[model samples]
Target chain A: MTEKTAITPATHTVPPAKFSHGVRKGDILQVAGQVGFLPAVEGQAPTVAGPTLREQTLQTLANVASVLQEGGASWDDVMMIRVYLTDTDHFAEMNEIYNAYFEEQGLKEAPAARTTVYVGLPKGLLVEIDALAVLG
Target chain B: MTEKTAITPATHTVPPAKFSHGVRKGDILQVAGQVGFLPAVEGQAPTVAGPTLREQTLQTLANVASVLQEGGASWDDVMMIRVYLTDTDHFAEMNEIYNAYFEEQGLKEAPAARTTVYVGLPKGLLVEIDALAVLG
Candidate 1:
């Protein structure tokens, strides 16, 4: 049996609850849903980056990447991704930012399978994302 | 390299878009988020099992189980699950139903690691769930 290990990067603030930033079992790592909130500094309330969906989407992906790296993986190792948006109207813009991120990472030809759905996010958050990666 | 294969069971209605119901990469099967809407009949608009959160949660789990089974898995094979609810007020009720389902399936000792978040589902939908299963 593969034991599950929690992965939390020192660079990231501790999550508010009991959940880890990511959990690794065998060769797989399942990351918790991440919003665009900036890393917590000791005594301040967490807040998302910019007010626009594009800005939040960027920060969210960056956060996901941080978690992936902490788990000893990379974007290339990600096999699937799920994007949650508060408004369907922002889907196209979110994808534009999303696609550019992968393209810049040199993974445009083999980007991971993705699913996007409109869902209400926490207050002030326009986007949230989580991912599954397979380590080679 | 492991190849990715899409799984779509005949018993389920085709999704509105291009994505598959589930995607298998090696031994890991990642199922797309499934809403509580009942399986489509020949000539009917899709509807959730009932208007209540409990009813919708049950049907959503069933739908997830069907997709998992079609991909050569069962609830026992599930390693992680994420639940999305439209209302945070329904958390306790959702967990009661969720826990009971696992108990009934004889998975009380080692239920899949789970994360629940508040998110709005499509209109008229109360819950949506997705899972990742590992096959031996």
Candidate 2:
């Protein structure tokens, strides 16, 4: 049997949170929930950056992608997505940008199964997304 | 190319929420994020039913198992899990029940890789969990 490896990426300047960002099993990568937090650049708080929902979402996805790559997975390997939004009114905008990511990659096969929830968010962030990717 | 079969269960009254509760891709079953609402019970509100996080988690996992059975998967097939807790303070309680479930089943293999998160949950629910299972 071939052994599988796992990757844990501790990024940015934030001290280690209780949980690792993600863990891989076999060929699958299950990413932890990622909220909209900017990479710390200096003395300012990372969460204070990204004043808009769209911008926060973009940053969140980028963070997810970084973790995915660390685990030998890519956006193309993502098979499922779970999105949490603080407001349903932003769904249209979120979907537009969300679709663009997959569309731009020209992923013509079965689209990644997804679920979007409109609910309260910790830190009062507007959006967050977690991903599952299979490298098979 | 080999043909793959799919299973979609509509037994519960949750309306599948945003999409199908679970999807079988290749040998892996991906279950969507499940909240603490019981579909069979009348007038079940997502937020208020579970007086505690442990109660909510059990109900949520039950809901997930129902869909897994429909998809020809079992609790033993679960390979990884991402659990969302509205408050990280509940982690100890969540793990107490989580360990009980797997221990009851005599799960000895590399324990299902798990990641826990503190986030805003739907309605007033305390916890939610999404899972990935490998059947092969």
Candidate 3:
């Protein structure tokens, strides 16, 4: 059996609870849901990137990518992604941002399958995104 | 590079969108979000198991397991599970049902990491779940 390892980027603070920010076992990496919080600052409460969905969505995607990097993967390795939005109306805008971001990244592999749904998150958090990546 | 294949079980109807029920590439399989719809009957709409949380929760889990089976993986191979609950109050009860169900399955490997949050599912649905499994 392949050993399981927990992954936390060097720049990230310890997750609030027991869970790792990402886990890698075998060739698979699962990134925990990441929100729009800006880069961590010790002794400072995590802050949302901004008030708009565009700002938060971009930060959320960047955060997801960072965890993937910590696992020795990248957006190109992702097979699936799930997005949780607090407001149903934000779906279109989220997709707009998501598409533009991925297009710019130009993933070399087939784009990941994705699912989006409405969900409530803690205050100031507009989006939470997670990913599953398979490294060859 | 391993080829990516979309998986749709024989018992399932074509997904309403351009997505697969599950997708497998190399050693990894990603199952899309699944709700508590009962087994399918050709020419009929998908139906929920019942109106209660337990009924729906169990069915939702069975739905996830079926997809894993389709992809040649099982709950024992799962690396992560994300659950979206329609009601905040359902968290505790859902966990109770979830623990009992997994206990009965008796997964032989490390239990998959899990995250749960409140969401607004379609009418009459109380939960949605998706899984990521890695096969040796």
DockQ winner: 3
Cα lDDT for residue A95, candidate 3: 76
Flag the better candidate by DockQ, 1 or 2.
Answer: 1
* Structure candidate 2, residue pairs in collision: none
For candidate 1, the per-residue lDDT at B132 reads: 81
Kindly list the per-residue Cα lDDT of model 1 for residues A72-118, writing each as its tens digit.
88876776788888886776677678767776777623345455667
Clashing pairs in 3: none
Worst 10 residues of 3 chain A by lDDT: A107-116
TM-score of each: 0.63, 0.58, 0.63
Looking at model 2, residue A20 earns an lDDT score of 63
Spell out the clash pairs found in candidate 1: A120-B120
lDDT of each: 0.80, 0.71, 0.83
Q: How do these models rank on DockQ, best leading?
A: 3, 1, 2
User: Model 3 over residues A1-136: C-alpha lDDT tens digits?
Assistant: 7999999877665688999989999788999999888888989877788999999999988989999998999877788888888887787677788878877887553566666778668988888998878887
The candidate that wins on TM-score is 3
Q: lDDT of model 2 at residue B82? A: 79
What is candidate 2's TM-score against the reference?
A: 0.58
